[model samples]
Target: MDLLEDYRRATFFFESGDPLGAARLLEPIVEAEPHNTAVRLLLARAYFNSAQLNGAEAQLRVLVEHDPSDHYAHHVLGRTLERAGRFREALPHLRLASAMKTQTDYQEALRRVETWLGKNSAA
Candidate 1:
């Protein structure tokens, strides 16, 4: 299949709640188009949804490193770290995401991480 077809299929799989299928399809696309941020983002989401925290983190880190102002990347990275039980590490990314975009999800994540950090610091 062509790249576009693969991308469409991967997206369909992801949206249909088959993240592993999406990830499997996306892996080759990512290898072929390393700098394709859109594909990378989708692949990252696939990894995130499939509970592949390490892979998600790696992809998100690359996205954030390439574009610090990418609110979605920051938000996903923060969520990935949070899922890994790294609240303190997730805090800055979550805050940055909220600062870059006024999304309710980002704000909620930032608030939750902040509360966790605050409680931990107080202890």
Candidate 2:
């Protein structure tokens, strides 16, 4: 199938709650287009939703390194790290995302991580 068809099918799989299927469809596309941020982001999200935290973190880290000003990348990376029990590593990215975008979701995530850090640190 063409790239567009693959992308459509991947999106359909993702929307239908089959993240593993989506990731399967997206993996080759990502390999073929390493610089395609949109495809990479979608693959990262698929990995994340499928509980592939390491894959998601790897893709997100690459995205952040390629474009540190990408607020969404930072936000997603932070969330992925937090989900992986790496709250300390997630904080700076979350804080940067919040500062860059001022999104409520980002702020909420930052707050949640901060609280977790505080609780853990006090222990």
Candidate 3:
């Protein structure tokens, strides 16, 4: 199989809003080129978009481990955890991502997680 062609098609599928299709195409590419950060990130994004939270968390964890300073990876991991109702676990990652960068979304996620934890803790 042509990896480049597959990557392009996967990207197309992702951009076309068929995240499951993108994920299906990306799985093999990620397996073939595990070190390709871009491919892995895209694959993680596809998983997240497709509501495959576990898949997204796995890929994002690898990305974070490979590069601790990857703000986006941390942010996505936190988001995945939050979506899966693991708010407490998502806190540190969201905080780290917010600290690493001043992106609005990152800060917003951090705040949302904190709120969830607060409300739940008060229960």
- What residue runs in model 1 are displaced by over 4 Å at the alpha carbon? none
Quote each prediction's TM-score.
0.96, 0.96, 0.97
The superposed Cα distance between candidate 1 and the true structure at residue 27, in angstroms, equals 0.5
Which digits, one per residue and each the tens of the lDDT, describe model 1 over residues 1-123?
588899999999999999999999999999999999999999999999999999999999999999999999999999999999999889899989999999999999999988888888953
What is each predicted model's overall lDDT from 0 to 1?
0.95, 0.95, 0.96
Ranking by TM-score: 3, 2, 1
lDDT, model 1: 0.95
Whole-model lDDT, model 3 = 0.96
1 against 3, candidate with superior lDDT? 3
Residue range 1-123, candidate 2, lDDT tens digits? 588799899999999999999999999999988999999999999999999999999999999999999999999999999999999999999999999998899999999999999989953
Per-residue lDDT tens digits for candidate 3, residues 24-120, read 9999999999999999999999999999999999999999999999999999999999999999889999999999999999999999999989888
Q: Locate the minimum summed-lDDT window of 10 residues in model 3.
A: 114-123
Top TM-score: which candidate number?
A: 3
